[model samples]
Target: MQHLEEQIAHLTRTVEELNSVVTNQQSEIDRLTRRVEMLLQREAERAQEGSGGVVFGDERPPHY
Candidate 1:
């Protein structure tokens, strides 16, 4: 029926829009994941080299 067809079309469009949004979100997640991994690796390397320069709570830096 015409009504059924219209409903189906609307549903299809909604699904497509949702799929696009999900795809974009996935891409952003992947990008952020990569950035986190890179930062972790960089931090690890800095730690191994003993040059992390990380300040702990209540601990004054050498320059201060």
Candidate 2:
């Protein structure tokens, strides 16, 4: 029937739109994940070297 066909078309469009949004979100998530991993690796490397004269939150200030 014409009504059934119209419903199918609408549903198809909705599905395709959702698929596009999900794909974009996935790409963004992947990019962010890579950035986080790179940052963690860099921090680890820094730790392996020395504290680099960095101060900790709990420690007293240099003027103390």
Best by TM-score: 1
Per-residue lDDT tens digits of candidate 1, residues 2-54? 99999999999999999999999999999999999999999999999999886
For model 2, residues 1-64, the per-residue Cα lDDT tens digits are 9999999999999999999999999999999999999999998988889764678899997798
Candidate 1: which stretches are off by over 4 Å? Answer: 55-59, 62-64
Q: TM-scores across all candidates? A: 0.84, 0.80
Model 2's TM-score against the true structure: 0.80
Q: Candidate 2 local accuracy as lDDT?
A: 0.93
Per-residue lDDT, model 1, residue 48, is 95
* Candidate 1 residue pairs that clash: none
Q: Stretches of candidate 2 above 4 Å error?
A: 56-64
Query: Model 1: which ten-residue window has the lowest total lDDT?
Result: 54-63
Relative to the unseen true structure, what is the Cα RMSD of model 2?
Answer: 2.8
lDDT of each: 0.97, 0.93
